[model samples]
Target chain A: MSYLAFQLKKVFKNKLTPVCLAILLLLMGTVLFMNVRTNPQFSLQAGAKSEIAYRQKEINRQQRLLKHDKQKSKTEVYHDTKAAIKQNQDAVKQDKQVQKAANKGNWRKAYTIMWQQKKQEQTISSNGQDLAGINSRINVEKKLQFFNYLHHEPLPYESQDMPVTGWQFLLQLNQQYLPYVFTLVALFLLTLLLTDSYHQKLDTAQLLPLEKNNLMISNTIAGIVLTLGSFLAINLVLFIVASLIYGTGSLAFPYIVGQYTGGRPLIECISTGSFIIKVIVLQVLTFIFEVVLVQFLARIFRDKLPALLIAILLVPGLNIATMIVEPLRKICAWLPMTYLNAVDIVSGNLGMNYQNVQLNYTSGLLTLCCSILIITIMILLSSYIKYKE
Target chain B: MLTVQNLSLKTRQPILHDFSYQFAPGQFYQIAAENGSGKTSFLRAVTDLIPASSGKVLLDGKPYAKNKRKLFFFESNEWLNVNLTSLDYLKFVKRQWHSNVDLDQELDLLGVREYVKVPIKKYSLGMKQKLIVAMYLVSGAEYYLMDEITNGLDEESRAILYERLNNEVTQRNKCIILTSHYSSEIKVNNLHRLVLHKQKMHEVKQ
Candidate 1:
């Protein structure tokens, strides 16, 4: 066997990589299954209905108050008529003064006097039973008018029916669940690759031809294979679980393609085939970048504890730092984490506008080329150092 | 046959300098030195495991740089992946060398075949050392550069190794060059002993 093949076989024989992949698949499968079972469409419909119902109930309460006030007003109309006329005249005078003061920029003083006058008028109006009934009836009438206005307002959905396409549903499911799966897989593979040698302390490794270089290369290959395989495996398992629960008919390649591309169905969106290819290529590029980054950390730290600590610190720290700096933010967009969020880019949901930037074939190729070049340089430098030792 | 000419090496400080030596086919050479001596550095330089500031090494009258595959170097501490069982490791090494040597019989002769299916992590220091020697023997290279090959071997394993080395040199006509502190145990009529001192090579006779 060639050296590369031997390295690959050795990696497959490792228990860490496989176990990491299994856990990722299991987690994704469980989350996806639960999400499908919960039926988000049902929840959305329920929420809309509850909001409408609450509004209607408020309108009904106001109508009932208006009916009660109408009956009371008939009994007290004659007794309160003179007092009500006098209060209206006083309120109109106060409104004029306040308006003038507001226009002249002495609004604070004017508001104080207007409030005092309104309180005095309210006390005078409440003195007689007929006056009190008239005031209550007027207030209720105003509230009833407002409620009537609301009743004429449009409902959340005019037809009371919202279609939930299988494709849109699946996309939502992936968005909610894929990130945790990817993170867990990355962590598991990194821990295994970084710690395997330290845990075993195998004496034969040092005796191999070009011992240090070989060991480092083997570990790196193992990490990359493990991560990539786990990623593919978890996604495949998710697809399977989704098919089983949602019915395989809803998961035909065309249906998935259509659903992913805004529900145009596969035949209608044949023009999007190139876009789909670009997405796949971008994903592969990001996977490679992630593997290289993990391998570099493993090589530098030489132990699981420090590797994991540095990984944890670096990921969030870089993200936060990237947000505060313009250049770093642009660079961060090309990072592995950013690429893992590639689905957003495909779905036209990026937070920033990339209108002038051509992030098509050229950008994807450039990212892949740069990642490979950096990884190659790191491997060569490491090998040279090992040979020197 | 191997030749070292005008060799100088340093590990943050000078260890060996202006060192020159030569060995013939079927010859057994012992490198002898006290603590802090350059015995290990000289061996490393010859094997090209460490870079020499100024030196040229020739194997069988040809520059070793041109033909590195025919040279084998062994250190006391073996560096094999412990994830693999001993038998699996032997198969891997055998494949790497691309030789038709039987690793099972070699391990048996070394008294380690019982642990062949066990991981190297489970092997004791002496067992691991024996395995290293077995791997070196199976490598079937023209020149064997060994460092402290007998350090952790039992009396029986040590005797077995000495006999194997003797047979490899006399019958197979291979050159065996090694470093050892146990000068009393090794006896050969065609033995050549060299001591590295004061940045130069000095001949030592027993």
Candidate 2:
């Protein structure tokens, strides 16, 4: 085997490393499965039923109004004022129920009911415009209904709830778990890289035919490979577990969003290929950052504990600093840990208008290019310094 | 063959000044000095492990920078990763050297074959030292630069290493430059000794 391959094999053969990686994968899978399972969109017991009931009520009211108006308008003038009043009453009753649900802290039920009622109104009025008298009546009726719901509904359980898109779920997982994995794995590998040499008395590695720079290059390659392997393994395990608990293929984007978001028309977010690309990019970038950090630490300390500590301390502080300092934050955005958190590039919160910035295929390609450049530079410098001695 | 010309090194102060040395093929040279006499520094400088304030090391008439793999340096502490077994360690060296040597034979020679599959961390200091020598032998470099080679070895292990080095020099015609406190054990085979004193290298014959 080539030296690089040999190094990678050595890294993988270690029992603890793979075991730790497997455990991490299991944990991530459990979290993702739980996130999918508890999602309000997938809950057949609550949101779906309320939505259907609300729509049926709205449809019944509209049909009653239509029947009353038709009966009155058999001859010359179509005077259906009584029919319109009954329609308004039905709308008012639906609005009151929504208000009651909201006030009772059943925000999911309220939102679903309100959404269904709005949808029913739109569908009923799709044919043509009503007279001024009828239009005014409907308008006043909707306003009063809305008012009653808002005022009377017990402000339903402050459902800080938004539909969870697949990308969002992955993003959340990355934010909470990726850094921990990256930090731990990087430190573990780096420690073994630096201290193991001393412990094994293999100082001859430094004296090998390879330049100090190349040796460092070898280490960096080893580190990147190990980190990537562990990361993939963890995610794969999570994918399997998610598939099992949520039903087969539920871990896939279309099904995942369908389960959580009730297969809403706006579920387009999870179905796009761009979402998967974003996730992969985020993972690659984070892995690169960890590799670079480990390389730098290994070169500087030449021992495991100090290097590990420095890495641990630096990541959190850098994250906080990136948040507080604007220019620095942009720089940090390029950092793996920071990039991991900022993967919601489409979320529009990073102060850059993603649309205006033309963040599409070209930008993604540029980011990949930039990542390669930074990683190359870091590996070169690290190897140069590390192998120097 | 290895040559060092006008090599000077300093760390916060001058360690060696205008030091020069030459070792021919099949030569076993000893670098002897008192504590802080720049013996290790000279070896490091020659190996390009440390930056020499001024000088150049030549291996086979080419500058050391031109051919790094041909020259191997061994420090007192073996820098193997502790998690690796003896076999794994040999495998790493073998990969670097691209050699097909029987590692089991080498391990047996060093008396470490029994621990071949055991992690290096479990080895005693003497065992670790022997393993270092085994690694240097396996590296197959043209020039071997070993610093404090016999620091932690027991008598038996030391004897085994001495016999191996002697055999390599005589049989394979490899050049070896080593430093050691055990001057008596190394005073054999017309060894050329370089004594470091007053910031200079002085030649001595034994």
lDDT by residue (B1-206, candidate 1, tens digit) is 68888888987689888777777778888888887777877776676656788978888677654465576765655445555666665666677666576766787788778888787778888888887788777777778888888988888788888888988888878788888888889866477888766776778867
Per-residue alpha-carbon lDDT of model 2 for A1-389, expressed as tens digits? 45566567568666778777767766766666566556755432254346556656666765666576686666433445445556656665666666666556675566565656655665666444555544443444343344334334423221112223433345555556665565666567655653444322224355555666666667767877777877766655554454454333222222111111221111112322445565577556556666667666665666667767887767655665666766664354344444444344433223231112332323434564576567668757655664443
Show the lowest summed lDDT stretch of 10 residues, model 1 chain A.
Answer: A154-163
* Model 1, global lDDT: 0.58
lDDT of 1 by residue, A24-122 (tens): 567655655555555544432343344445545554554555565665655555335434444444555555655555456563544454446544544
- For model 1, the DockQ equals 0.13
Q: CA lDDT, every prediction?
A: 0.58, 0.61
Every model's TM-score: 0.67, 0.71
Error of model 2, residue B197, in angstroms: 2.1
- Candidate 2 lDDT at A5 equals 65
- In candidate 1, how many Å is residue A346 off? 2.8
**Candidate 2: DockQ?**
0.40
